[model samples]
Target chain A: MKHFIVGPVETYKEVQNIYKQPYLYFRSNEFGEFVKETLNRLSSLIGNNDKNSLLYLTMSGTGAMEATIENCVTPKDKVLVINGGTFGQRFCELLKFHNIPFDSINLKWNESLTKEHLEYYENKGYTTLFVNLHETSTGQLYDVKLLSEFTKRNNMFFIVDAISTFLADTYDMSKYNIDVTIISSQKGLCLSPGLSFVSLSKRIIDKIYKTTPSSLYFDFKDYLKNIERGQTPYTPAVFIMYELKAILDLIDNSGGLEKWLSNIKEKCQYFREQICKIGLNIPTTYNLSNTMTPVICDTVNANELVKYLRDHYEICVNPCGGNRANYMFRVSHIGNTTKKDIDILIDKIQKTIEVLAKRN
Target chain B: MKHFIVGPVETYKEVQNIYKQPYLYFRSNEFGEFVKETLNRLSSLIGNNDKNSLLYLTMSGTGAMEATIENCVTPKDKVLVINGGTFGQRFCELLKFHNIPFDSINLKWNESLTKEHLEYYENKGYTTLFVNLHETSTGQLYDVKLLSEFTKRNNMFFIVDAISTFLADTYDMSKYNIDVTIISSQKGLCLSPGLSFVSLSKRIIDKIYKTTPSSLYFDFKDYLKNIERGQTPYTPAVFIMYELKAILDLIDNSGGLEKWLSNIKEKCQYFREQICKIGLNIPTTYNLSNTMTPVICDTVNANELVKYLRDHYEICVNPCGGNRANYMFRVSHIGNTTKKDIDILIDKIQKTIEVLAKRN
Candidate 1:
């Protein structure tokens, strides 16, 4: 089966094989060295400076986002969340759960944030901005350059959830001055789903030390202190950490992040070109992410298309939730997906469209 | 290496082999059924009622403890924590982080909770009580019968962290009137360390639905709804769930928990009797857990004993943290441990004690 459900993406065999070995704990020197090397590799791939502290949490992507809020965001920091989709709204949810005061620039499901939208928050004394760089729920990538410029102009700390966009899109924590960047193992990393990585700048690290977080499990201060010895405050999803190292090595061995990003970009462009030629409508035209394409189905219901693909060809594509469940479905370009695979998917989708026209 | 750390203990070969397969997601009916079956198997193993809700979180044991506090313990409920060791104190820390007021029955490192201790807190208007049934850190298994009687007399909601002693000891949530039971994969389950299980009674589930939780990631409400379809709100550590099913099958095939407990109890008794004959002190002798035995080192330092075993024989044992680091080390009888393995560990410890003189 071709798994393209946006996460728990296809992984390399070597990474999975690492799990065959019995559990490795910090007591073993080999596990300790593996953790330190993986931390270094992941930090390098994200282009973060040495001054920053990077932690791989043992939970999902949402856990990392909440950890960022617990450690970095305080009541004193008035936050502005760019609410575009599910992932964007998650930041607001986390902040609300922690009882932190914040306002959201709520946008329509397919709407992208523009300079005009950010201008309204400027000079409003907001000390922080939260965003999901690639809103995976809708496959819309916001302009980091615009967000960075606005944040720099206002001297606001910027936090980005790059869970789906870290390797699929170009991301440099140093370049964007991103105070905190959150990522997970299942999407671009193409590993298991439990491990989530949080990269914190020196500024964020300082703020973490100065305050008590709302959570004991998701505290970054404890994680940061433990990472010095190449361990987490609690036991982590260690196999995913090994898989993360394997994937990082794969990227580093095949040139670097530059080459990896370009390979994904080429496949993404090829997929988009073939889908358009076959007459499929991608809903959001502006600021599309290379991670996935959100296709709008008019005559053919998106729900049926997804079910048809799964039932007949043993293929899985991500379907939208809520009101757009039957209207839009997503085809991923991340993970170990290839041009040939994308071509086959497009052909299958075309065949699916013809067979399901009368049913829709 | 002969793995013997309290957490991430030695697992069966079949369970480890499950990890070799590629990742499984809820999209597959096989995985969905597997999770549903595992949830049922685990709930049954804990002897939870049919109306109780079970959630397997993709996190460590501490995460589940915090989730119990977040969902079940509201500010309206006055709480009491039985502080015995590191794990018991952890419950206190989690409650404090949420700003919920709770007093603790503080005991010495190896002190056991007794009936006289409970008399002081009796009728104090405490609505809930939290306890680590087996304090894995100090190898003291509290008498749950005594705790249950107290909580019942006081009409308090009883929450227990049965992480290290779930299968090793006799536990019936219904029999004890336990409102919540917390367990993790790495301890008695003998699986990987990422997944944590929380079993909530119908009453606790009703309490969870009444108020907003302090955490979004650890919210029981989202998890409870997703569990209806055999899923988590976020993606979980899938392979562990699969391994959990494999373990449950193994336990059922081997004549259920009663037989499993006898096997562990046999090995635990054999180990203690041998250590006593060999002139070693098994500390906290009054109420020790079948899961592990904490040894008190008088002549030979506990730190030296642990290091010598690891360096000389490639054997790992659970060492105490904080002030007891040099005075005590633990030998575990849980997680695929055999009587022969126990014999080997004891022999190694005896040899290490002879080899390292004046180390203390």
Candidate 2:
């Protein structure tokens, strides 16, 4: 089967190749160098300053986001979260769970973050801003520069969940002045889905060490302290770390990050064009992430379309959950997906849509 | 490299074979059935009643312990934790982190939990007891029957972190009336290290639903709601779940759970016998879990011996941490370890000690 799903993304052959070998003991100096090297490569890829420290957490993207919040934000800080999709809402939910007071910019599912959304929060004593660079739920790519400029002006510590957008889009944490950036393994990294990580600036690192974490496992201090010897406080997803290094090696060897992002953008554009030729269209009302296109399945039931592709052609795409299940599904271009794979999926989707439309 | 580490153990060729394939997406109906079947197999293996519900978490074992506490225990309960080793101390640490007031039965580094230890808390109205079936750090296995009887008479909820001992030891959760059993993937399951699971009783499930979790990612309510259809609330370690089923299949096909446990026992006995021939002995003052044996290395520095074995022999074992680093190490028989593998490790370790002793 072909993977077009947003994540647990289609892992490349070379990336998953790391798992066929023996599991590395994390405390070994050999494994320590491997872990440190991977973190260094990730740091270089993100183009962050020396002050930015990397933490590899064995959790989902949501867990990493919670860790980011627990480490960086407290009740003393008034936080502003942009809620345009499920993930953004997750930040708000976590904030509420932590009993931290926060305001949110709630947007429609199809809406994008704009300069106007940040206007009201300016000079309102908001100390932090939380956003998802690409809201995968609704396929909206928030303008990073717009939000960065706003956070810079308002003196808000910017936090971005770059789960779906890291390598698939142009993101320079240094350029954006982001204090914290969260990422997962399966999305842009094209690894398995268990590992997630966050990069924190020196300013937040000091703040994090001062604060006692609500959860012991989510504590950044332990992870940061252990990284000095290239270890985690607990047993990590050691096999997944192998996958991370392998993927980083592949990216470094194959024309680096720029070519990787461009390839995803090109495939995304190509998939959109092919789907459009067969009367399918993207209905989201905003600029999109290169990772996935939110396709409108109005001619055929979206769930039916997803099943048809999955069952008949062995292609899988995002079956939009909740209300959107009837009309919207996502076609992802990230994670080992190529133009050929996209062409096959689009060709199959084109025929499957016709069959389902006629049945309806 | 051969693995004898307490965890990230030597994964057999068969278990590692699962990683050669693609990563599965957790949202599929097929994945749901696969996950449900794995949980069912685990439940049967644990011999728990239908009142038990299983949760698969993409986290380290410590994360599972934290999740168990968040769901099953609250601040109102007067808790008693057994602190015999590092893993036991973790439970105390988590309880302290959650602001749950608890008393601990602090044992010496090599001490075991005995009837005398439980005698003090007998009539104190303690509502719960936390334990690690096998304290991995010191290779001390607590007597489940003794603890079970004490908790049964006192009417306390019993939570066991059976991360290292599950498949290696003959444990019957139902027979012991265990309220919750927390396990990790890399240990007795013999899979990758990223996934952890907890089996909670019906009583605790209802209690979990009523209480608000301290962290959003750890909210058992959301995990429980999603598991209705064999899904986690967030993206799980999809590939690891596949590995879970693969290993479960291997166990089922090859002599079932009983045989698997027996084999581990045989291997542990063989390793201990072989090590005794080399003048090394089990040092801990307790019954041992078939999982691993804490070895006293008084003739050679523990860390130095560990490095020598790893660098020259390619055999990995637990290099005892903290103060025990000079004289203690542990050799595990969990995961993909076998009798033949143990013999090889013993032979190499014996010869390596002579070389190290001469150099010293």
Candidate 3:
């Protein structure tokens, strides 16, 4: 079956082959070099090219978010989190769980975090600003550049979760002055899920050293020490590392990150146009992420369309859960997806919608 | 190269093939079934047959250890950890980092925990007893039966890190009255690294419900809630989970856990006898684990021997690090290691030792 879920999108053939190789021992020199090179390439891709600045965690995207809160936010630090979707809400939950004092700018799922929204938290003695660059739940890409400027003027550390936005959009950690930038293996990386990465600036590293992390697994300092020798403090997902290296090499070979982002943009544009042509609503309040498009159901049932597309056609699209289950369904444009793949998916979705209309 | 590292061992051919399959979207019903079946099989293998008693963490073995501590141990709980080697030392560090009051029974790398030593902390109001059943650093297998009896009598919670010794040795979590048992995919399961499993007894879950975990990623309560629907709280290592299911099926097909343990025993015994016949020293201060055997370098240079075997013979063995680097090297008997592979490794090691003697 064809998978169009937001993350774990279809991978490149070479990436699949790389993941098939046997697992390497984490302590091996060969594996060390692989880790070192992968981190270096990833740093260059996200514009955080520096020695000993990035760390790989054997966890999911949420784990990386927890790491940032555990390492950067102390009890004394005031924090502001942009809560627009599920992932953004997670940051608020983590900060609360850790007993850190924080305020949240809660936005509806379809709402965007704009420069105007930053006015209340600006210069409020907030030491840190946390946000999901692209909220996966609503397919809304927040204005990270605006947030970056706001944080810079306020002298607050900026932590961005770029899990679904890294390769799909243009993200420069250095330009944004992001203290901690998080990404995962699945999503825009087009690899299997499990591994998450955080690129910590030197300032954030200093903060991490000063505060003791309550959770050992998500501790940034321990991972930093191990990454010095091109290793992780714990056993890593080695096969996924291999896939990561392969994907990085593929990106480098294809004219670097600029061309990669352009390709994803083209795919996203094609999908959005095709879905809109079929008379389905696409939310316009926020800038859309290049990774996936969320179709807003008004007249037709979104869940029924998702089920029909999966059953009648062997195509799988992401069906929303909770309150949005009836109104939204997402189709991914990342990974080895081509315009052709998007065209077929849009055609199948259109047919499913027509079938639903007949049933009504 | 032939790998004899403690983890990332040579996986079975079928398991490797299973890992090569395309990545599955974590939210799909198909993946839900995979998670359900894998957890059921793992619970049965470890003898935790209770409903929703196990949770899978997308991390290494250390992550699961941290999860148990974060979930069960409170600031008021007096903890006693067996500090025998690196893994045991890690638990102490985790407890210390979390500001939990705990004492440790410090044994040398080669030393085993005996009943005489247990008298010191047996009735000392220790609420929890933490141990590494098989210390991976020195291949020293601790006596779980004796520790189980002691914990049961003292009314203390027992937590075991069985990462390196789960299927390689005979382990029955229920029989041992273990509250939390941690295992990883790469060790005795003969799968790749990246996935760690924790089997929490009903007692521990009840305790976990009362305490809020400090870590969001390692939180047991969140995972327990998600596992009811056969999903992890966060995105998991999907490919590694596939390998885990395949390895568990292999164990079931080949006469269950008992037969699997006996097979590993034969392989370990063969390697030990062959090495001893060649005049190499094996530490006898504790019972050796079936997972790996640590060879003591009393006369020969272990580092040089390891390099020679890797370069000239293409056989890779685990070289000790830091203080133990000069004294010990390890050969693994877990995974798909056969008697012939043991013969080859032993032959190469013997040749390398002779070369070292001539150099001296």
DockQ of the candidate models in sequence: 0.55, 0.73, 0.64
DockQ of 2: 0.73
lDDT of candidates 1 onward, in order: 0.84, 0.85, 0.85
Q: TM-score of model 2 relative to the true fold?
A: 0.97
RMSD over all Cα atoms, model 2: 1.6
Q: Output the TM-score of candidate 3.
A: 0.96
**Steric clash pairs (candidate 3):** none
User: How well does model 2 score by local distance difference test?
Assistant: 0.85
Per-residue lDDT value at B241 in model 1: 83
lDDT of 3 by residue, A157-272 (tens): 99999999889888899998998899999889988788888998988898899987877787788889989888988888887888888888898889988898999899888888
Candidate 2, superposed: residue stretches over 4 Å from native: B22-24
Deviating ranges (above 4 Å) for candidate 3:
A19-24, B19-24
- Model 2 C-alpha lDDT per residue in residues B1-360, reported as the tens digit of each score: 888877777666666676666544568897887788778888788777572288888899999999888878888999999898888898998998898889999999877678998898998989989999898888888899999999999999999999998999998888999989999998888888899988888777778888876788888888887877888888898888878878888898888988888888888888888899889978746888889888998998888988888889888888887989899888888877667888889888888889989998
Model 3 residue B315 lDDT score: 81
Predicted candidate 3 versus true structure: per-residue lDDT over B221-300, tens digit per residue: 88899998888878888777787878778888999888889998899898889999998889988998888899998778
Candidate 1 lDDT over B11-65, as tens digits, reads 8877877655554546556567768877987898898856328888988898888
Candidates in descending TM-score order: 2, 3, 1
A best-first ranking of the candidates according to their DockQ comes to: 2, 3, 1
Please tell me which predicted candidate would have the highest TM-score against the true structure: 2
